[model samples]
Target: MDEPVLEVRDLVKHYPVRNGLLRRSTGAVKAVDGVSLTLDRGKTLGLVGESGSGKSTLARVLVGIEKPTSGQVLVDGEDVTRLSQAGRKQLRRDVQMVFQDPYTSLNPRMSVGEIVGEPFAIHGITPAGGRRAAVGELLELVGLDPDHANRYPHQFSGGQRQRVGIARALALRPKILVCDEPVSALDVSVQGQVINLLEDLQEELGLSYLFVAHDLGVVRHIAHDVAVMYLGRIVEQGREAEVYDGAQHPYTQALLSAVPVPDPSVRLVAPSLVEPVETGVSTSSTSGGVGGGAIVLEGDPPSPVDPPSGCPFHTRCWLAPALPEAQPDPIPSYPPTDRPDAGLRLVPAVCETDLPALVPRPEVGSAAAPGDVPAAGPGAASHVVACHFARGLAAPRVEV
Candidate 1:
């Protein structure tokens, strides 16, 4: 495989919420805690999760929009973590971002041309003739008329404005585009058009993408690989098909089951995103389809500041540790010293008491050697899960 365009190793981003004038380091909200992913050159990675799952924060960190509290961010095999302000800015041209709200992302006052060409201006980039011809070409490339370059963002439709945003992102001829919920603000019909534009642009330019969205459908269509995030951590990740078709995590299973079926005859029997159809185009609860339905993890997304001690999800998890006397098969204390795989537990004792490591299940009789845990198959090597009993999860259910 070609070297990855972006590799995030145990990336953690926690925003400290301060109170009082002195600001004595109040607690930190774990926006993105321990996220590790590899995005190959020219390939797309869809990071999907609920509203507060730190998806947006992670994107900000990827492009240097926000700094990560810990972990390393490697772009093209070089660590960008320690780069100075100027260094970060230089890297920004290579890795650009398209924000979620087109209305808000674009400066309403600026003409489309200026908006699209801002990158060039910022980087002291002189496109032979001060960015005019280049801006026109960018507009045309995004499927909008070059003439519209003079218009303000307000003059265009939601979809059209989004096209302008895309044009702006492409001005620097970036190799990687970080899309943060790019289509959630558009009409459902328009979402497809924007998604198609991105696909076309990707193929034409060999661009890599870190597509951040809440929509499963959009992610399914555009992402080469996908990661399912919860709270601040990635619960499951693998090749798109492996994770989408055969989701091994209960959260994943619940998520996939929720996408509403368009067919009226196909009643949503179990708890999926769709319920009985109403006359109006029935849409699910969340802004996008994939973001909807699956039993919402209980409790508001735990405050990133001072997250729960045990497994972050355990506080809301139905399958959680209960009092030993009341518990059935008490949550198994993990990484016992007797087990060779023990040191994996670095969490506070609360998590250590009975925490789940997203380990992979070995094929029956496929253990590396006696007492050696089974090695994950090629496809599922990254398929490693974080849940304690993750290895014992039922084989993912395949729809097709």
Candidate 2:
């Protein structure tokens, strides 16, 4: 493929935690820690994760709304982080954002036309004919009547207001759109309309999208590729069919199992097929050993201020330990030890000490070879994951 339209390398955004009196910096919330991905031209990359998982922060960094604590944001092979003020402004013209909330994102005091035309004014580009005509064209482009351009935000419905937001983002004629949960606030029916509109716009304009949302169903429908984020990092990413159909990471599997199945008759077999590893301790404290085909995570997500050691999700992971007794087949245990009890007690010591790299599992084999795992290079074989146990889970239990 040609060079990606957008590329992120080890992006990190950390917010300082402040305390009383002097208001000195205490610690930092690692909102986005070491995230990387690539978006090809004219394609949508759906970013899905639970709330507080840094999806929005990542989006903000991508569009230059938030500065990264470290790492690079490259647009068409140019490192945006190194760009000057004038150069940055030029970069903004190529990338625009659609915020999550339509009501708050649009200025209620301003007319729809003013809001939509603001970008053109900021860039000092008088439209081909005039501002009004250009704004009217943008309004019509998003399916809103051009006459409604004079109306205030309060006068329009939620869906219509969002359409106005879309119009504004397009005023800059950006090649890449960072849609931060654009359809989440609208009615479910309205969401379908907006998604279809986005699809049409991408086709007509040859635009790329970094669509961030928690809605898996929406992502599945619109995304050509999918990246699953957990604890401020990408756990798994690949083609939509490959990642969804054959998720390797335990976190990915757990997330997929949580997606609601509409049919009552269809049943999942993951929970029943795998035997629970007995630690000889009570499982009641931690969600009863993963119930009903769902890996019920115990406790709230770890605090970003002080995230867990090693694998961030290991604290609540049901498959943290590699006890052969845990499943029908013996899986690989970490620490490179033979004695299962030495490593499989409660928390596997290797998971607590060593961080796993995002490695590509063997294409036709079950085990990942031992070596330095490379980043997802510019190729079709970019199905990379960040877990030691992922190789054992090369095949997913259900069609996510």
Candidate 3:
């Protein structure tokens, strides 16, 4: 953690919205607004969000494919955002991208060898031994046969073509790889293999990854840290467990609710995006948001172009301030916990009124999740969340 391999600060990407016969600009699409994160050297930071949440745009900006409207990208503590063309070339080569959609990413007419070795051709980099040998080494490193490099992209399966893409990304011996939903398109079985390959490579070569995907389950397994993006901004980010298990924001809770649970017997009461929380249910859905526990978020996410004032999630947040102070308490806790182990009671007003800052805190201890995000409170010792109720700062804790 001394010097992060990549640090993206307050990044923003806005696209003008065109309309009418003249095709004039009417508005702008807030793809990414004020996203800041640090990718540690030799670690994976998973970027998970719903589609159109700007995960890909951030990835593109990291690799120099898309310039940010504002903010900076620092590589090795040096600003790459203001670098010239030649400097960008050096930065781009050091940080490669494995694009989404293998079918389209690789040219159908080109042979695997040509696509993988194209970097050498473009950058005028001829390996010591030969270009052919370097390409072969790249293919083998990704678990593909070197001889098959002569075959066209169409001849290989979706997974194989993806491996080719990986080979291409590794062609330049990059220090970091920006993968945009690399496994979403492949079969379920193939997805595991590719994920394993990434892990193995990370261990063997000490590569850093900025992995973008919508699957929280996959993200949980591979990522050391997680950033939860909503609309165009990062609603919550911290250590993987801190954001998921110790979520202080309603949006983060809603996202965790959507991840299907392997078991169905457990039922949880979810929060309503547009309605205030009812009086009896426990606030913290202790059982991980599913089964006997659920935290359903009511209503849809609002448009990003014109986000609500105060809190962007206020419009659909179930923790709305509309409910009277004396309203009936159907669910006392967000994920009402009946067991003694359940930790931290959530404060509704603070969550709905002000946006929750992404602060690392010691996670609430539990059997299923060990040392993950604590249900609440800030600690001087380890990563912990400091919600109003947990830290005795904002909303006072109430008995369920």
| Candidate whose TM-score is highest | 2
Model 3: lowest-lDDT 10 consecutive positions: 391-400
Please give the TM-score that candidate 1 achieves against the real structure. 0.82
Model 2 weakest 10-residue run by lDDT: 264-273
Prediction RMSDs, each to the true structure:
7.7, 5.5, 6.4
lDDT of 1 at 175: 85
- After superposition, candidate 2 runs with Cα above 4 Å error: 264-292, 322-347, 366-380, 396-400
For residues 196-276, write the lDDT of model 3, one tens digit per residue: 999999999889999999888899889988887877777666777655555555566666666666554332213232223
Query: Which pairs of residues collide in candidate 1?
Result: 28-305, 29-304, 29-305, 30-304, 258-273, 356-388, 358-385, 358-386
| TM-scores of the models, in the order given | 0.82, 0.86, 0.80
Q: For model 2, what is the error of residue 279's alpha carbon versus the real structure, in angstroms, after optimal superposition? A: 9.4
Mark the regions of model 1 whose C-alpha exceeds 4 Å error after superposition: 128-130, 263-297, 325-361, 364-380, 393-396
**Candidate 1 residue-wise lDDT, 296-389, digit = tens:** 4434667777666656665554334333433344334332344343323211123334333445543422423212445444555656555543
The numbered model that scores best in lDDT is 2
lDDT of 2 by residue, 243-324 (tens): 7766766666666656667652232223211233443212322332134444545577899999988888777665554434
